[model samples]
Target chain A: MKDGLVVLDKVSYGYSPERPVLARCSFQLDANERVGLVGTNGSGKTTVLKLIVGLLKPTSGHVRIFGQPCCNERDFREVRRRVGFLFQDSDDQLFCPTVAEDVAFGPLNMGKSREEVRRIVSRTLSLLGLGGFETRITYKLSGGEKRMVALAAVLAMLPEVLLLDEPTAGLDDAAAQHVVDVLAELPQAMVLATHDPRLLGGLVNRSLRLTAGRFTPESSRDWAANPAVRSARQQTA
Target chain B: MANVIENAATYDASFVPASVWRLDGVDPRTRLIAAVSFSVLVTAVDSLPTLVAALAVVVVGAGWTGALGQQRWKRLIPVNLLVLMLLGLLPLSGGATPVLSVGPIVVAREGLVQALWIGLKANAIVLGVLVLLARLEMASIGYALGRLGVPEKLTHLLLFTVRYLEVLQREYTRLWSAMKMRGFRPRVDGHTYRSFGYLVGMLLVRSVDRADRIVAAMKCRGFCGRFHPLDHAALTVRDAWFSALVLVVLAGLAALEWA
Candidate 1:
């Protein structure tokens, strides 16, 4: 088994038999590598991320993180400590009442001291250009603001690998650019699953498309040049 | 569309004002103690004069705490409706002295007084809670409860419910709007009923799914069956003095009730 930061060895997962969301998928995310997973809706892009983070167990194949097999909560601790997974839905990620509390949640859960957590929370928010938003109510924030805050919460953990699932799914151009700029500055390995190839333009070095429950290597231009995808991006833009 | 959800999901923070009042600066634990103690005393009183006096005190407290604003007054409309219903119904049950007699219906003065006393008690207690709690944030309430030895599980439930209520409301609104876009005009029909039922079921399923996702997110952040608060406000002398004043006021109200 090749040691990588995150490795999925022929992982296959299904909510029920006779149907699998991810079928014998295998990939490796090494340190400082930027990988983009692109697929149509229901192509199981998110399942792959969940499998990497130990949120879902593979039915047939093994998954490894940092050369250790991730099977349960105990094993996931190491994975979670080193990898930050940004949920596709900002609402699901930012559950705390206040922005500051949500951003501090990861650090606090990591058992960081109060002062250290506060400093990291402030620094992370400012890095995401969300300074002075500490006391702002979470639900009151705009979608763009929520996305940034959610990212801040994940980044506050200072993970070595980022598993982002559609980080710019519902964001505007400005917000999307903001996220791109921030991710550009970060030095962590990232696996970004997004419909927007524009987001992967300068960020991801390699792209894979999940088709018929299996991942296949594909050029980013193939997805970006599709007429339907281009039209959808223009409509949202 | 994102903006619409953002507007719908916005928290109604108007319950607590932006500008700080003296009461706002008071410790949340102290305010919680005061509200609970005064509410108990107000509920215990049955006399019209005492309840009326308590109501007056509540109004004054609300005014002092900056809670006697148009928004806060709007929240009391349903309470007023309940009180009106009590006033209208209580008089129908006859008493010794009749205040109004009309075709086979007599409103007794005793019954009217009894209803008024109960209404006054309810108003006073409700106002007490509004004035005391309107200055504190929801997080502070959970913190104060946890500090006061409330079970961690209960406090966590309260905090999560309060935090997610707006999110759920937004989800419902979005679903309803989607239905409306599809020409779903609700009326008294089987289709409408079925549609509404499906909406509810969808909401429940989405809520459960979201809950699972949230739990997964928490665990991903290393949450291991414990909620560690990032900020903890220590009890200060102001809290002590405010609690002392509340105790004195409760004692006085008790004395007035008996005397």
Candidate 2:
């Protein structure tokens, strides 16, 4: 019943109790808000995204998506219908044999009619500038093309919120720019977990830095000054 | 490095091109049924003449389907080598009719005939499979299998294997390259064996992690433990005709076996 599309309140999670990955982290993603989650490796950025999507549950606190408590698989089904999560690795996300089938996967799972799934697959591919790629083999695609197809597959579901994990992790400049451009045009609330601040430019309105299982408000300039970020930016540039 | 990854990701580069095969236009369900039925028939015929006839039929079908390309021929090399090994070994087995005696080794005529029969059967089945199913993409094959009453779980397993095999291959290649860069030469030594064991362990861990991520991605898209295929398999006139032709050929082969 809140305005936030996703709200994680005082959430704490760990694979084992002795080694907590996230501790009492709280965040709110409002409608149409694009929030960038930046963290060092193993800083629990992916964990937070998983918790929001209900793949992983909080140990102590609550995760609410679309103003509903996401506590179980049934509750998550409703959340997942409104939120799409892109895995950090494109290989993990795009598991279908062909690009068309992969894109149609989400819509078809929603029990859409065959004709509607076909239309959604085609439209989603074209939206990502991947027309004529229906029969393209998923494994044979180039790195950038695979990422684009993975994103297209996510977008095919027509989610209200997008949870993207490192959308530009290993992509080249052109591919990363393509992703940035495609994402910039989307109106959905987005929570992007990435280390590259440059990828967040003109897309995410605010940045949250995760450190020691905690979130803090951070400016893009502060992130740009980090040596690792500068090196990544230079490599992409 | 990127080029290596790209090459690793290329799925079954030796597969015959669909464009080369006119039969590629046929429904996958029809092709799969025909291939499976022909393979069964090839296995059933025991006589040399009938087996040879089956091989002839396969050769003709392969030619018609344009499966005689260089890439497909390259794939047959291993099978040909195995057949050669069988020919060399099987004929040396003890039997009633000795055909050739070389000092201590006696080659029997019956054994030789048996080897030839098995080889011919193998060749027929392989050729039939190549022409009928190899030209089709794995996704189509999975769909066809699903339509043909294969268990849903098995069909999905096939699809997942086809989809992720290349990804795991890439991961292995990257790990191997890293080892090579670190001066890890693979010789017949304990270090080399241990390193390989470690590599396998690492690859397994990476694959499991990737599977976890994939499950999360699936759940995020509202996956409910069931896959819904976008394309429905419907038998058309062409499929019916293809099925009839295959049945007629199989029947002719059966008649030849009896004759």
Candidate 3:
């Protein structure tokens, strides 16, 4: 019942009922809290985000976003509007033929009047410092540029909560720094799930580790104290 | 944005069915056989009624496969109208006794009927091909082609074409966006056409460059000329039986027509 941005209460999820990937996973995020979720491969980090977005439903327990139950179509829809999900693979998320079209997709799909959608798209592109990238073909974008375009597209949606899955997954030092800077500047509750530690430096005050398909909260200091995590986090920093 | 999310939440993934046709489940070889069989049967037959019947079979087949949903059917309705128009025009190809005459238009009943037949047959062919392509990945088709006497190199070309289309579409989209940002508007003027030609020439150059980069990447990953599927599809008992059933049904339909 608390006014948390995201609340997962003992939720268990798996693609198949017989085999559970996320076992009784639970967590909560308050407004403007930058939380990091770290996990090894297949540790259900990405699955957690999908569950919050209602891309996958829990087999048991519940997930509440903005204090409303998350699984219901209506609530999930509202949560989606309030939350921006940056899918790990920008290729799948960026569906429009052109950079401008891709950024405009979420707005257009929302079906605002033409002029309003145009304004929103233009504003988002300029905000991302990609003002004239409207006509640029999405496929022609370099890996770094594509990441920026993807970020710009999500920013255009203007969600209250941003769930970023490895925003710096495939980028050089400079590109990754740009993304980190953008994340730092954004003033919203964010749950960043990443394998990279540098993206976590100075941004997150709390850390949650995904081990054996469940989240365990640890202090930001302890997360940074871990030599391995520190080394990975420092790379992007 | 909240409103949009709410709308998307109401959306169900089930709206798009996972399977497209019988070929969807069958082994690549079997799917290829089915596609080849259907394509050859439809093309070889000169008789209008036979072709019409073949078209009906494909149409029904698509529906049965659960591929003929709202989107596919929506595309078909407009196409059906255009086909009707074509049918109307066939009889009026300056034939004698263009039966019905409207202002500035004459309808030749025979030509019109013939046109209808052609249109129906064409649609049938298109429908069958779509089902095949929808269910069977191009690699599977390439494998089938290789199995059925197609040279390794030609099969490779088809595979490249299929993959290239996706890449080209993405490239074209980016290029179009770039042009749009520069306030480029498409016009019917000569300058527009000239720019369009240049765009196409650029596309070819980009495709070649992309292909080289991809080849290099693949080489780095130790890729050979051949790609082995993660799941090697084979003819199960069910697939064999399904193929038999299809052959029997098609033969029965053909016999009924003969009778």
Candidate 4:
């Protein structure tokens, strides 16, 4: 197996064959790499993430995770087991009745023993400073707390590569800052699709831009000119 | 008072606190066993006296859990009234041994006894359902059902419904508010039905759009819809003992009746 984390070779995808959402995009990640995906609303940044996670298959290309083709169910499941994801809407990601159950979901899905699952869930909760909230109903949590719980659930899965979609949206200044700090401290390689400048600032060393329907390299300077980007940066830093 | 009982048995958003419930004291499985046993034993009693005793036990149990708050009683009254009315009308139908006669109305002894038994049985069943809900939360119920050989796809659907019901409700409220802002009102005539039809159509469209976005998001996160219950607290020795005790007590009562 190759040492690289992920490899997408000339991948092309679309909802319908006539309308290609993502066109022949290719990208790769190495161990401990931090990459930021930036694009407009209709751009195919989200599509790329879906393809990597095997949610959507590319029309004609290959997506490899940990050196293996992520096309079959067995391959995708193996990849999914080792990759934690933070979805755009916190509500969509969190579906459990209680905070603890939500956080323990991924670990449980991976079929860990009961004791180990409990320990990992508790540790992740406390690490996020949510120690006294095991039994709290998930719906009753504040937006920021819900985000933390969502991340904690994935962290419990203990993935090697983490993918986040707008992790800081709806969070207040303090909560967003806390999220930034938490993301920075993670040992895993990360690919963040975000509009939060604070989350993308000094933390991510590489930036991938998606325009119209293709992937291209971009710089921090290019990202600074956009009004939406400016607002997100101001909110964070 | 009526509202109190209703709130206890029904879904109340206010009852769900921000903090998680502790699973330390009693195993949910054991509580489930106890609840099922109690419900069956009480439901089997044909005598009014035994039925009343079962209802009392249920009430006491609810009280111990602090679930017998004002909300619980409020909910129970309407159902109680309905049961009363049904039983009251039963004596009027056919044969009657008139213990008391008032003009055209005859209150028969058998009818009175039968009504008491019916009320007792109804209360016992209601109490049992409430206790089961409180002890075995939705997640555990889903897990138990899944373990009992329910199909994964159906279980996922149930789980999705549970998760998204609140989201759908919030969306519906927002849609209603938007309609109200536009001076939309329900008329008593046929126009009201047409307007309602329009509203439902819009709701369906919105739901489909929301579902699409949700599916996209879930796919990005590697969701395949086969849910596995997380580190569930273990069923302890105490749990077994309690379950056995409940079963034994109910069996003894049943045996006595048989003898």
Q: Which candidate is the best by DockQ?
A: 2
Q: What pairs collide in candidate 2?
A: none
Which candidate would rank higher by TM-score, 3 or 4?
4
lDDT tens readout by residue for model 4, B114-209: 776777777777776675455345656666556657787776677666666667666666777887898988778887688777777887787787
Candidate 4's C-alpha runs over 4 A off are A1-5, A28-32, A67-69, A216-219, A222-237, B1-24, B62-65, B84-116, B131-136, B144-161, B189-259
Docking class of 3: incorrect
lDDT of 4 by residue, A113-232 (tens): 778878987899998889989988787789999899989988888889998888888898889878888888889999999877775655687888897677788787755666655775
Question: Candidate 2: deviation at residue B90, Å?
Answer: 2.0
Model 1 chain A: weakest 10-residue lDDT segment is: A228-237
Relative to the true structure, how large is the alpha-carbon lDDT of every model?
A: 0.83, 0.83, 0.70, 0.73
* Residue range A1-237, candidate 3, lDDT tens digits: 456889989989886767678888888999889899998877888889878877667889899887777666556666666678886756655544467656765665555556776788789888877889986756557888888898887777777888888888989877877787778888888999886666565678688989876888765665566675566556645
On the 0 to 100 scale, the lDDT of residue A30 in model 1 is: 86
Model 1 achieves a DockQ score of 0.76
Q: Judged by lDDT relative to the true structure, which candidate is superior, 3 or 4? A: 4
> Cα deviation in Å at residue B185, candidate 3?
49
| Per-prediction DockQ | 0.76, 0.80, 0.02, 0.37
Top of the candidates by TM-score: 1
Q: What share of the true interface contacts does candidate 1 keep?
A: 0.85
Taking the tens digit of each residue's C-alpha lDDT, what string does model 2 give over B11-103? Answer: 356655557678855899888888888888888887877887888888887788777665565556667889989999998988999998989
Pick by lDDT: 1 or 4, better one: 1
Q: What is the lDDT of residue A45 in candidate 2?
A: 92
* The 10-residue segment with the lowest total lDDT in model 4 chain B: B16-25
